[model samples]
Target: MASSVTKEISYEELKALVGKSQNLLLVDVRTKDEVDKGRISGSVNIPVDSVEAAFAMEPEAFKAKYGVTKPPLDAPELVFHCQMGKRGGTATNTACKLGYVNARNYAGAYKEWCEKEGK
Candidate 1:
């Protein structure tokens, strides 16, 4: 896979998206245990280590596993996050490598989500 610049989204922008019913997929790269505590309301968990494989799966298989449609390669809004930001960056890179050109990292991640939500 070729190296590619990882795009990022700000907390403000993410908050706006979450408030809308737009075509968005927020992939949480946290472990099940961590995610079990809480997450951005509409996000999905697909642990960091499995990002590449998850994106590689056929759409049907992905849907079966993730319970959401597998985003297409050209999906306009594919965002990844984790406890903080590091793993989110890693997952974004992985997606970019697989040709998800619009994939982005939520730089503030779940911690920022909780803080902003006053959790």
Candidate 2:
């Protein structure tokens, strides 16, 4: 399925980015418990419920609210994912509306990640 966001990153691309970039902001939009099961390495949890508050706060406040540093308005990339794809897509759209043009969704999401790991 086509992602609503223009910059949808595939699982392969995301895996490469995780290894290559330390500054990339990877967010898991699943619930806390879903995340507790496991999340992509380097991804911070941002449960879809709190997306607005995370993006709308001041830099310092954003960091405290979401437990991740606020990427600059022109940040290069902010990647999001959920267990499947829906909530991550919602996050990508919300981030764009909040002026984070760099936000991208991991189209394959965490379900794909787990499946691949079991292979």
Candidate 3:
């Protein structure tokens, strides 16, 4: 069945979610090089520039990398974050257009998370 898209959490809410053992799909839409500096725990690395490519990958390839089966155009819950809100917001929009039912943009992104969490 087709599912409805929704933003179930804000940046602060996402921080709480991070503390809990939730089955969340947290994506760091930053370059691999940038992620080498630091990143949120439990986040998958999918550079914003490569999201389209990643989504277009074969199911088995995508699953091997992301650990989830191919998500329908609108099936999984995705939380995208970048250095600042800009890239994350853009990534979120793209994912929504691609049919992610619950794609959220973490406005604070990594910078905010680092500042708040003192990382």
Candidate 4:
């Protein structure tokens, strides 16, 4: 695994990123059942269990299914989140291994987001 595979961001930093980056890709790496309870608005659904599968299969297939487009080095960041940030961090690491330079893990994932969003 690359050293840059893990990049964690605070909730405030995440909010700032969202505010500034229109092209940001916010991904929720949680189970379908968990997501049914509640999730951040506009976050793409990608179950954590399936991440390894995506990497095992064709990378482009995963990208297409998730609507992720390849961007230049200066492209907007890709933010991932999960129930408590563990899965999100894992996903971010995997994404980085697959060449996503701007992959970031939202440390205060759905749990913190929900509290802050007053859910």
Candidate 5:
């Protein structure tokens, strides 16, 4: 299914989902430089620039490359985040453009995460 819009998740909702949802895939869209400083504990770095490439990868290849299960194009609850809302929003738009119907952006990104969850 082609997605016309990107979904959104609040910091509190995302935090709760992280605690409770094993099926969640939290992707960090920040660059490697930003990630080198620190990142959320369970987030896998996809870097926004490479989102299309990641999605284009074959199922096994996507898993091998990203270290996470590759959900189908119409999969539910695939989320993206970055240092702030901007990159994450862009990445989510990119994912949706690539036909990832459930692509979601965590608007209150790493900065907000730090405010709520700390270093």
Candidate 6:
């Protein structure tokens, strides 16, 4: 069973994890239009509304649809973010319920990312 505790990721921690590539899956829970404006590089857009179904997909099906391999239940780190973080927190909860034990929300989100990056 997955823990009930909600996990969160800091911008500094997320920043450090970004370049390692293989160790984490960055999921953006913002809409495609919002994501079009900008997003944390290396993050995949998976609008919050579709999160449950998306995670339920067969790995091949998910990859075919999203163009990225689906992270397994035990994936090292499955990080979610949105423009300001609320949706990301919701997505994180959804993922956790689906057995993504390592799921975390980037509480700072893209807004913080942009501010930190001076954009």
Which residue pairs collide in model 3, if any? 73-99, 74-99
Residues 1-54, candidate 2: write the lDDT tens digits: 444554688988887889689779999999999988898988889889898888
State the lDDT of candidate 4 residue by residue for 1-119, as single tens digits.
Answer: 32555888888887776656778778889999999998887788889877656644564776788776534434456788999988998888887777777878898899998888788
After the best TM-score superposition of candidate 2, give how far the Cα of residue 59 lies from its true spot, in angstroms: 0.8
RMSD of each: 2.3, 1.9, 4.8, 3.4, 3.1, 2.8
**What TM-score should be assigned to candidate 5?**
0.90
**Candidate 2: deviation at residue 76, Å?**
1.0
lDDT of each: 0.91, 0.85, 0.77, 0.78, 0.86, 0.91
| TM-score against truth, every candidate | 0.94, 0.90, 0.81, 0.78, 0.90, 0.94
Please report the TM-score between candidate 2 and the true structure.
Answer: 0.90
> What tens digits encode model 5's per-residue C-alpha lDDT throughout 7-90?
799987888878578778899999999999989888899988898898888999998888888978877678899997888988
lDDT of 3 at 58: 84
lDDT of 6 at 115: 95
Quote the lDDT for 33 in model 3. Answer: 93
How far in Å is the alpha carbon of 31 misplaced in model 2?
0.2
lDDT of 5 at 17: 79
Q: Output the TM-score of candidate 4.
A: 0.78
| Alpha-carbon runs more than 4 Å astray in model 5 | 1-4
1 versus 2: better TM-score goes to? 1
Give the per-residue Cα lDDT of candidate 3 at 71.
61
